[model samples]
Target chain A: MEIKILGTGCPNCKTLENRVRRVVTQNNIDARIIKVEDIMDIMSYNIMATPGLVVNEKVMTKGRVPSEREIHELLTL
Target chain B: MFLNPTKNREKAGIRKYSALWTGILVAIILIVVFVRFDLFERLENGVNWFVFGLLNLPADSHLASALEFFLYDSIKILFLVFVIVFLMGIVNSYFPVDRVKNYLSRNKLYGFEYLMASLFGTVTPFCSCSSVPLFIGFVSGGIPLGVTFSFLITSPLVNEVAIGLFVGLFGLKTTLIYVISGVLLGTVSGIILQTLKLEKYLSPWVKDILSKAQHEQEVFQLEKQSFKERLPVIWQEAAKIIKGILPYVLIGIAIGGLMHGYIPQGFFEKYIGKDNPFAVPIAVILAVPMYSNASGILPVIQVLVSKGIPLGTAIAFMMGVVGLSFPEAMLLKKIMSWKLIAIFFGTVSLCIIISGYLFNFIL
Candidate 1:
């Protein structure tokens, strides 16, 4: 599994990224998590809001941080 | 959206899309509703009694107080929004984006830098929408993410109306506290962002924009103009902004007016007042989707204050309404992804709640 966190480095964006990392670690998910900070790449996904989460190739959430349980569900699915 | 020349000419010739038509439509609707509901008749009767003070009224009655009860409250709010939106237009028109970018783009993101950026943002009269564009400009100019965050946090939290109202209603000490808290929130949030090293999460497009950026040095080089010339430009910009925001201002005023004249005092007190420990958080949550500027909502605040709502909670609600409205979040969705928008809302809402609690304790 692959998870990506996206934003332009605003505080909220950073917080979301950190939360994603924590959730990934705590759940012991066998996934490669990556952070994508570039604006163009994020825009290419047609997401206008930042601090987004992409699971695998699909965009999971935008402009928010999801709880560990939510991340776990996304990971499992 | 190809426009045929004949259709364009016919459309121009019709003159149907006029402000007068809009104004007339609004007036008709208001009049029809008031008449149908007997609201106007009641208002007339109420005014006469209130004005003459029917029961052994004092000879020297305060007309201003009476006027304030009915009209001034709404008028003041509309006026404040007008001034803010007008000033925002001026800042947008006159203040070159590159100037702000240059000032904030130092490579270092020290505490002092964060403080300065936050203070600068607080002083400048930029609305959230305008602030986003400037934030983008700053990021594009290679300003450190933490420093940029400082500016973004303080911009909406420490607006001019909020400061003035704090000073006027709550006195200097409370106003100072609000200002200090705003700065502290910005600084702490920025530091936290820096610590997380979240720059790596920014989308590649932003990186590309920043990497290719030769700073537009010429943009800020203003030629010295005579005061007369400058005045006209300022007036023109103010007029343009006023025209754009006038309808929204009026709508806010209308809602405020209704709340002032009709809403029962007990309602707000029962639900959202200081007696309820949960009021602060509940108000914050409710305020997230509602949109109103500081001025438009002042009348509601006035009623809430009179009805025993906690000052901190009321202000928090106001801040959430203005700063985190759903429209704002949605508008941002055009520029940011849904994930980013959610995070932004979460962070700002948390900050607003913290400030609310801080004010409640200190005040």
Candidate 2:
């Protein structure tokens, strides 16, 4: 599984990175998490807001950060 | 759309039209009542008193005065934000900036095109930090490098909130100078950069993004929509704008408000006054590090004006704050290399410092 965290290192982005990393570690899922920092690259995904999450090249969520349970559900699926 | 006269007089029936007129009348009456009663003033005082009660501080204390300014300015500035955001939604619904961009980008006349682009930038309302998205759109629309840079520079620097604050705080003459200088700076810098042929400095992937053949083009055919049909769309856009930007507005005003009441009077004059020849460059250099939304900087500017800073120096400082924001530069970094970003910063800073000293000398 490929998970991409998209942001430019704002506080919310940092919080999201922490949350997503924690979720990935606890779930023991075989997933590769990529942090996309470049504005052009983030724009290429067509997400409107920052702190976006992409799974397998498809946008899972954008703008808002989700909870731990939500991440787990997304990962397991 | 609010602009369709036909929907109001001809088709809506006498009863509906009468109701609309009645609504208008009532709104006018309420506004008159509020003004006559000085309700806004009363509300401001009420907030101040409430803050005093919460803190149990003396009415004449510095802390109390600071709290009052903070609360009052935050709420007042935010109210302006709401009204401007709503009106911009309605206006954009009719004018549709992207269409204007599409048509205007085709103009080969560099100087005139840059002027028009800068004017449009002033009209298009943004809360703050929205230059990158518009930059993407302009670049993708095939606008020239100079014209796009002019639009990008003018858009963020002379927004609705900034202009509104300028007019309210500094009066019409200063506002006029500001708008002209801002547009001039944008135009000159754009022409300079374009003449330099620095397109190679852009991140190469920008081409890939432009050529990707994927942009959503489903602008609702507003010309076809009945008046009733467009109302909800305007409302939705306004709501989206508020939801997206209110937090930034509130936080910005909050910080600015604190600075408003707390900062000592004559602070600028002591440091970067007209008497101090190095003030303009020093003020410009100081502004780059203190990043805040343009709105956040408004209250501070308010305090600056009240502090008797030289007009040119203060405006130079404001230009510095809005034009030289660190985050904004960083955001642009993804699309351009460090060198280009530095040039962009250096060009604008030099322009602002020059304007500062020029305004001081002239005005």
Candidate 3:
């Protein structure tokens, strides 16, 4: 699975990235997590707020960090 | 189809409606008690007694007054912060950024759009570091540059945290003036910048995105949850915000306490007093490099006002500190040219100064 975390390196973005990583590791999910900090790259995702989560290139969430269970569910799904 | 998974928690039933009504009922009761019982005055008196009578501090001493000021202001300010943030959290969960962005993009309110944008900025909670992505998002999403500027300018200046502190520190009249002035600053600055046609000054990367952004924009699917389901998240967010700002509030109040008690009445008056014609502009100029959120600065502003600084000058300084700062400028540098950044800062600083002078004149 491919996951992209969209942000401009804000605190929320960092927390979201860490949460995603932990969920991936603990659940032993096969996924690559990429942090997209570039303005152009983040804008393309159409998210007005930081800490967006993109699962398999589909924008699953933007503007908030989901809980670990939510991340695990997204990963499993 | 993937979005539906997130909506699994949106339970539907009479229970949800009942929860909503219960919340409203509780809010009404709190407001009734807060208003009818004279809670604020009683609290002030209680603090006064605690400091003077209970602690056995001399009534005439500066230390007693300072201690009283700190305890009263901190409690009142912290309580106000929690209530305001919690309420805003619920409001935010319902009107999420996605919905707000969509609304702004799709609507054409003529000149009112700028005001609308500014209002959005006032309510939406995002860290200052998120400005770049938010700027890019609004711009790329076909929102006009002026409207985007309105949001960018007002987002930091007028927020719930600031509002709460302002109300606690300066009471209703001054707080109202501050809020109205903040919104006007954003709106007026936006209109002025919009007239300049600064589109060409955006970063080349933004230009590239603009060139290619005309395609059918994807509708970001978001889960719709009832307030009941959103309550837990909202509570957490409110708590998090209160925790984050608690330190700044206490420190600000502590400093304000010292200034309140010990600083002679004419101390600040001798320097930035109302008699000084240049005080407002000087305050604004001096505040440019100092970065602080409203929570940290408002308490200091209270003391400055008490010390005989014109209300206008101190408020201008507060706006300057809260609204325009080097770090925010650095963040904006990501999406704007040096020329654009300078213009943005220049315009905001000018507005803040004018506001300071106006405030001094009126008050």
For DockQ, the strongest prediction is 3
Q: Residue B260, candidate 3: how far off, in angstroms?
A: 1.5
Q: On residues B38-114, what C-alpha lDDT tens digit does candidate 1 reach at each position?
A: 76346545655654555434544444234434444334344444444444434433333334556666334355878
Clashing pairs in 2: none
TM-score of chain A of each: 0.88, 0.94, 0.96
| Residue lDDT tens for model 3, B138-227 | 776677788888988888888778888888888879889998999999999999999999989988888877665542245544455666
TM-score of each predicted structure versus truth: 0.58, 0.65, 0.89
Question: Better model by lDDT, 2 or 3?
Answer: 3
Q: B108-164 in candidate 2: lDDT tens per residue?
A: 564588788777777665423345655666677667677778877887677655765
**Runs in model 1 with CA error above 4 Å?**
A1-77, B1-68, B74-96, B106-109, B123-132, B160-180, B210-220, B239-270, B292-295, B330-337
How far is B117's C-alpha from truth in model 2 (Å)? 1.3
DockQ of 1: 0.03
Q: After superposition, how far is residue A42 of candidate 2 from its true place, in Å?
A: 6.6
Best of the candidates, lDDT: 3
